[model samples]
Target: MIKVTDALNRFLFENTPVRGNAVNLSNTFQLALNKQNLPLGLKRALGELMAASALLTATLKMNGSLVLQIQGKGILKLLVVECNSEFGVRATAKYKGEIRDDQTLFDLIEHGQFVITLDPKDGGQTYQGIVPIEGNSISAILENYMLRSEQIDTKIWLSCDGNSAAGMLLQKLPETMNQSTKTDDAIVHDLDAWNRIGHLADTITDEEMLNLPIETLLHRLFHEEDVRLFEASNTKFFCSCTRNSVANMLRMLGNEEISSILEEQGKIDVNCDFCNTHYSFDKIDAAQLMVSDVAAQSSKEIH
Candidate 1:
């Protein structure tokens, strides 16, 4: 199989109690935006959020999706990013008022709760955590959440320049966290290694982070340590919307609501916000949908 150029990478310090993830998004980032016009600040925020979400998803052992959402009460009305186990990603943003290009990512948000949701693909139990907005940048907000809520010492750096997005994460684990067999001296060395590595990572400029390839970037940052790079996972821009999903959504609107819309408009037209795909349903389609739902419900009852 062909390798994925835009990918997620995992690396480990062989002798240190630290692990890291770096993601570079090029075509995927542009595809995710998909012609949705947004302000400069909001676009920057969305790009960083997408990169961060992809990195966090790689850290999990989940065959599902991780969603990052920010409900803003200011110029940036809202932002959402979702990354799945297979690395399929999609995002959307909303805003009002004027957003200056010079505004910081945090400046767009007056107040909001940061929410992280883990949704299993196989109908497994979902988990969600909401935290107060404590940090300014997307990187800072995620780092704060990991440290406070997940009890992990995580440092994240993310940058996006409309065309591409990149993010790097450094996580410090306790000696016992991984159940490693090491002497006290080794453990002490691990602690020191984390400090040194974090410092090195900090020295990486945004220009290098956004332009350098992941392998070159890793080698440059951790040349002193024995770094093990894992197989890269493919990533792409994908919107998980289909005609059936749209039908189910319409059913949830109830028959009375559907009739009102159909009677007034002659046909019901729906659009997917993430992908901008259009779907239209006429009266005949609506009737067929009702019949199909009844048949599906009856089959389930029989089973």
Candidate 2:
């Protein structure tokens, strides 16, 4: 097996209006899990989404974050993965009941909604597109979204084997790809290339994807084509959970309740759902938090 690093590699077909990305996460996958003892089914599902999120984030090249989520009514309540501009990623899932190893992601979900959110870091309005989950695999569901919502022809392949997560994405560049005018033959040729490349990518196997390096994998798939591979960007585990955010959450529980808990336990502890980091506040820290919260609210009311 190849040494699969946590990175995203972009590529472009030299003569066709097509582009792609390949990503494999090993260390990132383990970090994303944060040592959570999860069922095999849910663990694999979350890993796949984490890989998919990295590909999509690279596609948009957005600054803030891109969130891919599935909300369902079955045993798997919610699964979400967020990837930021720097290729940092994190994922978490909420599920109950026994998720057997034999059951797949789709088998554990029911009447799920697939949501893609693009949140800009520059205080821009977040954009979300929601659609009913219609595919059995994460690849198919995201491809459907790209085709339906963006009208872009996209193909994605994702795989995870509890140890690592890997995926590849190919998109047929739309007409607005360039300002240069093209003749009808040029348009036809581009379409032909897109079809051929997609077919080649379809031949990838899960073992190859999870174990092969990105460039080697691409070479095997597109050996005859003129493909340019770009430098890879690292994908690492990152969680935005902070002490201040946890403090605000404690404030939401109300001062009375907070005091009651503190009086009983001598401290308050909060754990982030995304990453299993613990935020602990003893009496003094809790009291100061309450004092600031009250002062901020009072200032707001006065204004």
Candidate 3:
């Protein structure tokens, strides 16, 4: 039975230096795609990315958010998904021209770039990694990035069927020195174990990934090996956009820009691409923003 829904399950191979995560997004996936009018193929792609983002976020030890983006120069211009430490996920996509149902990843995104950014919730320096798009699917591209850029041997399998999105990730942990010494024999053993478990995981079919319960799936894959499954972490669709955030963004545009926009459009209208939430600012709101900014500046100067 598929007991896990909109949750991530972490597991470890007790005897080997390998760890893995599995994520299945149901209502969360549907809610994320509800606001967008994406093509079928692009919708599936975005769903896969959303699942992948959650899986990647689970691997991080930081207290912030992880953003995965694929920007292309072809029909599919941009695909972005963000997952926070709490497993809150949001996704958006932009595409120009027609995207056919039969088009594959390479066919839609022709000269693309994959970028990953880590934004800490607390005041800290953000880190980002950029690489040219590699591989044909989102799973393959991310696996390539994990191996080449992050220098971690990673394997990812992603599946999205418009309604639900699911993914599984297996990673080989770095060798640790036990008993004050590291030897070639230990390294060789770790390598052999890693390869063996990876091969077992490779046989999982997409149907199983999307349909099987976490316990059943893991047992089927690693029943022969000693594995320990951790408690599942809940995942949900969440958008962090608010009217105040939109106001702050407008404040950044300065008085002149805000005035110009207000004049041309009568009122400044901003719609969040992720959730399709609308925030409108009229002349009064714009004036209040400038007034608040001036008052804050005056207070700072006086101190």
Candidate 4:
């Protein structure tokens, strides 16, 4: 039976020296797709991006969020999804032209750039990297990104349907050795093994990727090799938007702008593109928020 859960799993291999992760998002995907009418092709693409982002987020050893974004000049104009250490996910996509129901990544998007950003929650430094449209597939672009920018040996496999997305990542750990020995040779050997493993991973099929269970899939890919799998961390689709949050955003625009918007439209309407959640701010509500902000500032000054 198909297990219904949002999980992030980590694994390691023996003798060959590599680590891997498999992330599956079902509940999160359903939550993200709720109340939105998305074309099948677009839905698949978004699901793949969602799974990719969740897998990437799992690799983070620090407390932070990872944003995976794709921008193109073709029918698929933009797609963005983010996953945080807390397993919270949110996503949105925009497109143009004729969206075919059977369109693949290359069919919907001709030319695009993939960008990944790591933002730490603890106010640490953020890391951003950009990759050219290297391959026709999202996984290829991600592998290329790691090689060009991070200079790490990495592999990514992504699959998505309308209601679920799943992905796997395999990375070779940095070499460690004794300075008194021929350690450079060992490092090179490990690098060769990493490449070989990546080649094996390239043989994964779309059907197998999407349908097979995590344990079965790993064994199918690396049965002959020594592989260890870890427990799965759950993921969920969540949007950090609410009436209060929208109110605070209006406060940032200042009272004059809020007043002008209220005067013109009678109410300030803010719609979250990610979740399509709407928030309205009437003149009275805006005024109260402004007053509250002023009062808080005054109290701070008094202290």
Candidate 5:
């Protein structure tokens, strides 16, 4: 029997300009999907996005979060997934109309836009990129974006079956040539190695990706190549929503808006889309928010 883990593994080829990451999201995927009442196709798409988000976040060298979003005008309205530098991930989807089991990616999202955002945790500036949706699969869409926008040669393989989501990413880094010691033959050799390894990774099957362990999969693909795999990093589902965050949002709405809602519905109920957690603010709670704000402002003025 093979042991499976929800972890991301990074590997590099010796003396080659190729690097890759493999992720298996068994437990994390299920956890993310626990409260979602999504259709089969949409659920699978969200899972793939979760896996891809993890793979992309692992490739970056930043202490921030990476968000992947797809918005469409068809039955599927939105699909969003976020992954931070620490390998934490969460995903959610919004859709209208009936979703058939046989729906394809294009069928679900007709006029879609793909958006990527990089948000730093330390109050740094955020960067965002948008591109018209292309291709039918998430892998093809992201591969196109990486090659066209970032100028990096990338290949991604993603698979999800509602139970498990897994993915592998292979990237060919830019070759750095030492003008003094580099030879034309060395550059040629590097290109050849990249092509060889990329083709080997392409031969991976969905079964192998979702079932095989990272070590077995790597060895199976690059048995003849010198591969160095780093320590495994755990991946899990995490939601950043909290009662304080909700309170802040309510405070922004002001006393008049909150009081109106309190009168009509007796309480304001907010549900987190990612985790489906419910937060309620009653009349007393609403009044207390304004009182606290006034106190804080008065204290600041006195100081």
Candidate 6:
């Protein structure tokens, strides 16, 4: 089994109109590191992205997926993670040269744009927001993006070492308490609840985030507040690439290009970047795939 202890929890102030989320990632970080031979710096960066992606996904009210990508011309060329509403996760990173031994975010990806793409699986158009890299930490950059692009008051705290990565998010949901609600009513009735909630999140330490279970961590953070915790969701390292997916790409390339590859390289070899799994098709296998492709095309025409 893929042992990923990443959990996402949605919480409400039970009596208040404010809502929040806290996400944890530990083994998930190790799983991503285990898949590729990444440098210490890149590994740390990837872990931050993993945790950030999870936190971002957990806040989605719509049934869709979010993809977090950072692209630049510096050492850390690319970092990407896709998280669906179901909490399924996968990631990939590309970089060149020695990731400075004691590198920070700026040291690695000099100038980049952090992008979040929302893909609704129910056949709707995807939306993307691009934000310039504004801060040294991934959390800061994301917080800035949320405020500047989405115009929502948001605060994020993310921390990661070589062994594990973790984060917390406090967002202002769209809701208003009934007019009868008053500050003298209860602890949750105050508008300052969002700031106070963020203060609690700030007290969370990296060790707690990396080791403690979600239940323990949440209780520790907001013990005094009336928190409504949702069922924890599971996250894992999953890649959607397969030999058949590669074959579909070959069909898209058309027969001439496919034949040219066979004539030159003897066989077509494809490797999935997400998992580093390789798929090779010999000339006969390639020809059979082509025949099936033509039949599918003919059937579509007949229909």
Over 1-303, each residue of candidate 6 has an lDDT whose tens digit, in order, gives 232267777667665556666666666666656768877777777788888888888877768889999888888889998877877677788888777668776777777988999999898899999989998788888999999998888888777787777777877765553222334366345668777888888888888777777667778888998777777777776677888898998899988899999999999999777777899999999999889888999999999
Ten-residue segment with the worst summed lDDT in candidate 1?
176-185
What digit string (tens of lDDT, one per residue) describes model 4 on residues 204-291?
A: 8877776777788888888876677778788888887888888888888887788788888998889887889988777788889879
Clashing pairs in 5: none
Q: Which stretches of candidate 6 lie above 4 Å from their native place?
A: 1-4, 176-189, 254-256, 288-303
Give the worst 10-residue stretch by lDDT in candidate 5: 175-184
**Which of the predicted structures, 3 or 5, would earn the higher TM-score when compared with the native?**
3
C-alpha lDDT values of all predictions: 0.85, 0.88, 0.88, 0.80, 0.89, 0.78
TM-score of each: 0.91, 0.92, 0.92, 0.85, 0.91, 0.86
Candidate 3 Cα RMSD (Å): 2.9
Poorest 10 consecutive residues of model 6 by lDDT?
175-184
Q: Residue 169 deviation, candidate 5, in Å?
A: 0.3
Q: Where does model 3 exceed 4 Å of error?
A: 177-190, 293-303
What stretches of model 4 exceed 4 Å from their correct place?
A: 1-4, 73-75, 96-98, 105-111, 177-192, 290-303
Supply candidate 6's per-residue lDDT for 266: 100
Over the full model, what C-alpha lDDT does candidate 4 score relative to the true structure? 0.80
Sorted on lDDT, best first, the list reads 5, 3, 2, 1, 4, 6
Better structure of 2 and 4 per lDDT:
2
**Candidate 5 structure quality by residue, lDDT tens digits, 111-195:** 8999999999989999999999988899999999999899998999999998999999988876552221345465547658878
RMSD of each: 3.0, 2.4, 2.9, 4.0, 3.2, 3.9
